[model samples]
Target: MGFEKAVMVRNSTACAMEWSIELEKALRPKNPGRRIEAIYQIGLRLEQWSGEPEGTMVVYDMFGLVPGEDRLFANTIFLRLADAFQLGNKRDVKSRALALVLFGCWADFAKDSAQIRYLVLSSLVSSNVLEVRASLFATGCFSELADDFSSVVLEMVVNIVTSSETESVVRLAAVRAFAKMGCTFSNANRAFKVS
Candidate 1:
């Protein structure tokens, strides 16, 4: 089904939940290509639903899936993030940013604290502009996971903000993400002081 029609039919919490069941089925194909295609389609559908509250809930549901039971999901996220970092346009960057946020949400739900921390740290040091932007969004989304990685993420954010070699836009994005996470300036100062 087309994304627009599917979204129109599944625009509520209940419908999104039902749609997720179907999505899982689609993602369960034995063929690796099929599984990857299903993930790509879901990403596209998510973009269509981005502005709706139900969309966010669907994202949550996507994260709620058990990674061990479906390793393809994790693989899809990694591939998507890699692709996003390679692209150089605003639209691709935003789409990839959202995908990384989804990945962060999944990691948070899975309690993969190390992966979340590693992703932020790696993104901060990346030379690609789009990757840095995606990293900022991913870190902000990781905070929503409310995992034990907040202090780590906050430290990375402060480092990004303070680094002179970082691009201005990337630094600004990090600052926005830091504020979104409601990090305290005093904590940032203390952390920076000790570093």
Candidate 2:
């Protein structure tokens, strides 16, 4: 079963220049949704290479594919970038930081996995001042998290909600994160009741 699944995944990721070029063209236009879609497609393929021999090389290629002057692609690009870091390679710290920022945004949208959530939170909490100044979360980057890292991210949501200094949009993102974490108002209230 595992072999079959792996083969199916590999076939799905078979190299194709046409789609890649098309994605590049859309990225050049800097269309937010289109760029995100391209990133999603590319990420699917990259994810397939998790333990493959050339996985690291493929990830590096993705990083280099980052569209110049395209902010829309920046978000999606960085999400993949973080994966690159996790897989190994500390050669480019700047790229790592950029990717880490995006990873946090992705995790905010991701589901209930303590490890994934902690990975993102660790990145966020340990980020240097310059990364924070980059405003990684300010943009329309993370619409929703997937169900892989939800619980560990809730504390971040709480911080964003309670902090007076946090930006309104950032707070809004926290609200959205809470909703995605499956913590409705009643669940949240129950915690306070116990506290």
Candidate 3:
């Protein structure tokens, strides 16, 4: 029955609001494992809905359901990911990272790009190299919003790339992030000038 409902929600936006409400209830911090599982399920469903208008509406509705100070539930999701990392559970960590990426994409699509970009930038500058790498991957969500973030993001990425104390993998990730953001900014700027 739950599987059927999940499928229904993905296929149509009519029931998304009620379903999202239930899912949000399950996402409360009372049970960490359950919350993680919920986030994973949301990521899977979001993937299924990718590029569809209905899916976009569903994401927008879900974000609306959450309080604004909650950062569209990003804080809750990241807290769970942080806990998984602290436990050194590689599988859980990867799953949570994927979930974060999905959420970031959804946020960008929902026109909340600035908030998600800032969140990713803050994570990248964290002392933990693992968090930095995860944030670098998440930054891809804001590729289209490069014009809004390019300068600050470029400065931060360059700093990471030049810092000798940074891990090799993180530095590489930062380089890639820089390239992606730089290209996006240049393209956007050219398009604006052309228009």
Candidate 4:
């Protein structure tokens, strides 16, 4: 579904509520993953229109349709991908990985959902994936915990920039990410500085 349709459905109220149940059933791993894939695509489309917070919330809420039972692993992978894109990223691989991590963490800082926060944070703290870590670092949720997490992410960005074998583009992206969040690199003798 496109953003237009998602908004229309949300406004429709009847269709939105009905699809909420169907979307949950379709998310079951026992069923074909393609249905979940379709819903994910629809969510992706809606995210493009995220300027409308209510519409974005309505669209994001649809993700709850995926049953939260008997599909931990599959759902984990699925939600990760969803969150990466939803959280926003430039590349496909990075976006997908970030999605998984963010989706896993949504409930942590979300409205009255403690279990989700715990589940996601526990997994995030243990994840070995750099993109996942980066995604969480960049999320709005991370900002609440930023005082606790920024130094770590700053270190990651520094590491990515300093490593000899890292790709130039990746280093550039790290710089961009840091600048986006008001971080700066200070070098005493450098002629040009990025802030």
Candidate 5:
């Protein structure tokens, strides 16, 4: 194993690419410890500005990596980010939450094209607070695409708003998300509004 790595090191390009792919592996949360570290690192990649309204920094600005930019890898880093976000499992919760919030901020290129609708549905139902908020934020940004499942999301959001069990903060976020999705939700609202 050591000898193989030594030979690969001589090929600088391959070495760099190899390491880049290896680094992408870390983006996946293998456990709780790594998720926290990944969240911090991902946060650093996303910019923050006090000038923005309410000092908000919800979007990712391609940070240091762009989708088509030259980089050392067989696959681009953005694709790796998409995969990490797309995993949508409890172990990958933090990074997925981060990705969810960042989605539609720069480009929707990170979305897994094959399972986008499914991804949207799963995101709405996630138990994590951050995941829920992030999903709402992302859906608001991509309300156009979200039109495909706006009714489903709207129904869930309505439940959240009406449910006494839901926290006030989460209920508020749900209302805001519903408003953002109302482009589709409005036409779909007739059913719920009647009662």
Candidate 6:
């Protein structure tokens, strides 16, 4: 069953089959509290769309009628989350992080493109600690594919680590990512020193 079918099966007035304007509002930079709430509710809906449940009941669609979950997710979900994150204010870390997690989930199951790497990698430089951490985690989720994020990931991590003013905690995470990328230490040590 596709996302549309799943939504129809649920038949909730709150979650209409059409793309709700509420979802777009939820992705915006304003209203951090409301953003998190909306993303959490969306996650519940997504679980049924993907069919991997954890300690929750799932509605079985015995007949496969709808025909396009992957395309819908790639087109609409990516737009609402990743594209929104790119356009929204970077200070809105809560929404940024939540969007990343949801976007990563969709990318995990879809036949993703390099376009997504740009979306995820852009989050690496976020001044907000939580957003950067979320981006790093999401990066890991996608790195398992043959996407080849090494240069971009390593370069960003290297810049972060080599920055004299970067927070110790964030620097540590960057170093971890740098290591995971399997790049040599000397390469990162050669940063242009933007101070």
TM-score of each: 0.51, 0.38, 0.61, 0.41, 0.57, 0.63
The Cα local distance difference test for each model comes to: 0.56, 0.44, 0.56, 0.41, 0.54, 0.60
Residue 169's lDDT in candidate 6 = 81
lDDT of 5 by residue, 1-195 (tens): 997664333232223344445547666546755655654554444333111222112211212333322232323544555566665456556667676665545224433343444554577777777777777666656554545455555666777778887777777877777776645446466427832
Q: What lDDT, from 0 to 1, does candidate 2 have?
A: 0.44
User: How well does candidate 5 score on lDDT at residue 155?
Assistant: 67
Best by lDDT: 6
Write down the lDDT that model 6 would get: 0.60
Tens-digit lDDT track of model 6 for 96-173: 788777765665643265555776787787778888877766665665443356544656766778789888887786
Q: Is candidate 2 or candidate 5 better by TM-score?
A: 5
In terms of lDDT, which candidate is stronger, 2 or 4?
2
The digit string of per-residue lDDT tens for model 1 on 74-185 reads 3444444444334324333444444455565455443354544565567666667876887787777666565345566777777788888888999898877777564456
Kindly report which residue stretches of model 6 are placed more than 4 angstroms away from their true locations once superposed: 1-22, 28-30, 51-64, 109-115, 162-164, 175-195
**lDDT score at residue 38, model 1, on the 0-100 scale:** 54
| Candidate 2 lDDT over residue span 1-195, tens digit each | 986665444322234333445545544533445544555565555454333453334443543433222223333344334444454333434434444444544443332334334445554443343333222341223324442233334555566567788667555655555554555565466435533
Specify the poorest-scoring 10-residue window by lDDT in model 5: 49-58
TM-score of 3: 0.61
Clashes of 4: 8
Query: Looking at candidate 3, what is the lDDT of residue 190?
Result: 51
- The parts of candidate 4 lying over 4 Å away from their true place are 1-9, 12-36, 39-42, 45-49, 53-95, 98-147, 184-195
- By TM-score, how accurate is candidate 6? 0.63
Task: Write model 4 residue lDDT over 89-149, tens digit each, in one string.
Answer: 2333433443443443432323123333333333333334555354444432443444333
Better of 2 and 3 by lDDT: 3
Top candidate by TM-score: 6
Model 5: how far is 59 from its true place, Å?
25
